[model samples]
Target: MRRLLVLGAGTAGTMVVNRLRPRLPRDEWEITIVDQSEVHHYQPGYLFVPFGTYEPEEIVKPRRRLIKDGVRQLTGVIEEVVTDAHLVRLADGTELPYDQLVIATGTHPNPDETPGLAEPEAKQRGVHSFYTLEDAVALRDAMERFDGGRLVVNLIDLPIKCPVAPLEFAFLAEAWLRERGLRERTEVTYVTPLDGAFTKPLAARELGGMFDERGIALQPDFMLERVDLDEQQLVSYDEREVPFDLLVTVPLNMGAAYVARSGLGDELNHVKVDKHTFLADGHDDIFAIGDAANLPTSKAGSVAHFAVDVFVDNVLRHVEGLPMQERFDGHANCFIESGDGKAMLLDFNYETEPLLGSFPLPEIGPLKLLGESEANHLGKLAFRWIYWHLLLPGRPLPLATSMSMVGKRRPPAPSGNGSSTSPRDLQEVSL
Candidate 1:
């Protein structure tokens, strides 16, 4: 029997196995998945935890239970990959050989990479983040005690999972403060390394205007050097300081270390793979999907879901000695929580920047793009149910895998003196 080994039982790996198990002949194939933890988390829900929108238990489930019964599930730490011998080495010294391998270990926040973040005294000093379950729960308690003061939200680096999450947190926090009648005393500021509110000019301008209207200050182009615990300030590379009573930061994110040790990953420990096809640069039998691969797209679950649709077909064709016909276009869509029971949706691909339009249909969307609505907020909340029931199970969604321009249109041309530049004038930048 041919053995197929998968690393990490997260969203991408779990979906890949569930979708392929029924299609591949069980008598001829032995599929197995390995992960260090038995618990699977709804990562997006982490954004809601601190705001009391979700409890910790609401978004977690047993990893073993989620996998198909026909597929073997192994819980153990991966030490390294013996790529030449086609086997992965576990920390406990067990060796699992495979005819084919898929790495979906994903990326993680490494606070230690930045000075004063991972220090034992950081939490006590009011440094916190909602990136993990434990951290989110702790931040919830902190939010309860915060009456009024400087509440600063900052992003340390780019390419973090769910690039819009920090902005969402800012909007949610501002609304939460207002609801508690603490908005008058609280000074809310967002600090980022980028020159604008977001990477895309149109989105950034829209979001920046919202920040201004909401009384939240934007400190742009601030390259954070370190957290000054004693002074309770964020020190930048250019020697500017932003003092805060409470600091919520998104730490630097990097891929799993095993990929680096195995000599298959790039500088950030992400596996080097072809952008169109997930095949690793030097190996035919190996593939990397999700955040583990160096794809020029946002590291969001939507990207993972869409990429899996393309990857399954490509992998099957590749195993049969056929060229992969499916090419992923880095399709990604995200709901930006804009506070006050409303949110905005963004849809784009490798070739197109987010444009104003309806989604899933031209000018007929129940959902709107680059515009706020209560329906969009409901859609974002309703996705949690869909993720657990349909997405992870590899069932097809009504949405298409590739991005469509059917409903999308560029903004109206700027007309004042012909001096103002349009959003189209700004070059598109990718992850």
Candidate 2:
């Protein structure tokens, strides 16, 4: 029997195993999944944890519960991937050989990349991050004690997981403080390296306005050079300083160290894969999906979900010696929580930027695009159920793998005076 080894049991890897389990002939193929941790985290829930909106118990589950019965589960630290030999070395010195390999190892925080950012004083003195479960729990404690002060949410660098999460945190914190009757005393600031609220033009415009409406200060283009725990401030490379009583930072995220040890990844340790097929370039019988794969798209759960849909079909085709029919189009969609029981949804692909309209269905969508509504917030809350049931189980979603542009409204043609027709068109445009 041929062996199919899947690395990491996160969102992408879990979906891959579940999607392929019933398709591959059990008599001829053996599937094995590897990860260092046995617990599965609902990463999206991390954003809500600090605000007491989601409990720790609600976001975690056993990895084994999500895996199929026949699939083998191996929990250990991966030392390296010997691509040429089709083998993987574990920290315990055991080696597993495979006929096909899938690398879904996700990214994690690299606080050490920034000097003094991970120091003990920073952790003890109200400096917190909500990327991990531990960070969320610590942040909750910090928030509970904070009566009123400068609460700064800073992004250390780009390419972090769930890029919109920091903004969401700022919005949620605003609402949280208001509920506590501390909005008048608390000063909330969102510090980002990007010139605006988001990478997308339309989103930046809409979200930027939301920040203004919620009385959240926007400090754009602040590239963090280092954190001054002594002064309780974040220093930018440009010499600009933002002081804070509570610091919530999104530190730099990097891929697993094994990818670097194997000489199989980029400087970031993210595997280089074909953007369309997710097949690892220059290596046969190897594929990568999720944040581990270096695709020019948002490193979010939705992107991983869409990639697995294409990857599963391609894997099935490869085993049958047939041409792979599916192709990943850099599809990504996200729901931006705008606080006050409202949220906004966005849908786009590699070739097209996010447009304004509706999602799931172009004209008749229950969710609006580039617009905030209570329904969108409901959709975000309902996703936890879908994640545990449909997403992890690799069931087909109602949405397409590739982003659909049917229901979106395109920017109006530029009129006279070097200005566009719509206010949203004036924002930054990226494809």
Candidate 3:
């Protein structure tokens, strides 16, 4: 029997094995998945943990229980992938041979990469993050005791998992403070390396306006030098400092260290793969998916869910020496929680930026894109159930794998008089 080995029993890895197990002949193929942790986390739910919207037990599940029958689940740390030998070594000295390999080991936040952020006393001094379960629980405790002060939400660098999460946190924090009558005393600030509120131009403008409306200060283009623990400030490379009482930070995210050790990763330790195909550079039998692959898109769970749909067919064709017909367009969609029982949705691909329109339908969507609505918030909340029941089980979703522009429209251009034109007077073009 041919061996199909998959690393990391995360979102992408779990979906891959579950989707392909029945397709690949059980007698001719043996599938195995390995992960270091025994529990599978609904990572997107982490954003809600600090806000008391979701409990810790609600999002955690046994890793073995999530996988389908007839697949081997191993809990062990990955040591190295001997590409030339077609085998992977575990930290305990176990070697597993594979006819084909899939690397789905997702990226992780490395607070130590930022000086003074990972110190033991940093948490004691109110430096917190919500990226992991432990951190989220800790942040919840901090938020409860926080009376009022300078609350800072900072993103150290880009290409982090769920790029929109920091913005969500800031918005939620602002609304949370308002509900508790602490908004009057707390001075909220958002700091990032980007020149605007977001990477996309139009979305940045929309979100920047939201920041202004909510009275949150935006500190853009600030490259962090280090965290000044003594002064309780974020010191920039240009000598600018922003003092804070409570700091919620998204640290520098990087891929697994074993990828770099195996010489199969980029500068960030993410595996270098073809943008459309996900085939590892210079290795026909190897492929990397999810945040593990260096794809030019948001590293969200939706991207992984969509990519797996395209990847499953490609894997089948590749093993049979056939050309891969389906090409992934770097499709990604995210729900941006904008606070106060409302949220915004963004859907785009490699060639297109986010546009204002209705989603999954033209002019008749229950969900709106680039605009805030209660439905979007409900959609975001309802996803946790879908994630555990439908997505992890490799069941088909209503959405398509490739992005659709049937309902999207570009915004009106600025007027020649150097003033913005009214939306009602401008003619919008379909994207």
Candidate 4:
């Protein structure tokens, strides 16, 4: 049987095996997935852990349990990818040859990359991170003991998984403190390197307003230099410092080292792949998906799900010696929790920003885009179920893989006065 080897049984890899197993003839092709560990994490659930909404057990599952019946699963730490030899080397010196390869090893928190943000720093100061299950649980314990202080939610840098999570954490912490009658006593600040609350101006303005309304200060353009244990402050390279009594931070995010060693990665070690096709540069037989790929889009599970849909089709076409017909548009949808049983949905692709509108069905949607509502909150809560049951299984979702502008109201061109009269742009549309 022709070998179809996969590296990393994470979000993208597992779904690949599941979606393509039945499609690829078992007699002609054999599928195998490899990972360094047996444990699989429901990563998005990590966000709610600090608030005690989810437990570690609820978000953890065995990787093997998620794999399809026909696919073989192996546990091995990836050492390197020998593209010239068409083989993958493991830590134990075993080399697995592959006719076709898929790299799905996602990004991870690299605290060591930042000076004074490593183990010693965390141990000395009250530094905490909620990126991992253990980190989330630890942060929960830290938060439980935190009665009133400068609660800082800091993002060390950008291109992190679930980019909105820092904002979510700040919001949740505010609500949590308010619920405990400590809101007035505590000061919450969101420190981000980005210019505003988010990368996009429209969303940033909206979110920044929310922060102001909640009494949370936004410290934008604060590039972190180091964590100052003595002063209990986050010091930026420019000498600006944000002090904190309780520090919650997201350190530098980096891709797997194997990608770098294999010469398939950029400076950050994320695999260099075509943004649209996800095929590795100079290698048609190799592909990178999910956070492992150096795409211009957000490194999110939603993006992976959408991209996997297109990727599955493309992989089949390639295997059959046919041209890939589909192109991924970097479509992403983020459900932003605004606290107090309210959430907002933002849907956009590479070209368009999230517009305020009714989604899926115009004016009749159960979900609203770029606006806060109870219905959107319910949708966000319901997604956890869909993630486990549908998304991971590679089953069809009601949402379109490519972003649709059907329900959204675009901003009309400049109107009135000497302005080039046209419809208002989506940026001008109020939430």
Best by lDDT: 3
RMSD of each: 3.0, 3.2, 4.4, 4.2
- Alpha-carbon TM-score of each model against the true structure: 0.95, 0.94, 0.96, 0.94
- TM-score-superior candidate, 2 or 3: 3
Rank by TM-score, highest first.
Answer: 3, 1, 2, 4
Candidate 3: deviation at residue 17, Å? 0.4
Off by over 4 Å in 1: 361-365, 416-431
Q: How many collisions per candidate?
A: 0, 0, 0, 7
The residue ranges of model 3 lying beyond 4 angstroms of the native Cα positions read: 361-365, 416-431
What lDDT is obtained when candidate 4 is compared to the true structure? Answer: 0.88
Query: With candidate 2 superimposed using the best TM-score fit, by how many Å does residue 108's alpha carbon deviate from the native?
Result: 0.7
- Model 1, 326-422: lDDT tens per residue? 9999999999999999999999988888888878743436588998999899889989998989999988788889998878888875577442254
Better of 3 and 4 by lDDT: 3
lDDT of 2 by residue, 1-431 (tens): 99999999999999999989899989999999999998999999999998888999999999999988889999999999987788999999989999999999988999998877889788887789999999999999989999998999999887888888998889888988999999999999999999889887767777888888989999988999999888989899989999999999999999999998988788889999889998888987889899998899999999999988888878888877888998889999999898899988888888887888877644446588888899999889989999999999987678788887777886674467543334655565421
Of candidates 4 and 1, the better by TM-score = 1
Which stretches in model 2 have alpha-carbon errors above 4 Å? 361-365, 411-431
Expressed as tens digits, the lDDT of each residue in 213-254 for candidate 3 is: 999999998899899888899999999999999999999999
Clashing pairs in 1: none
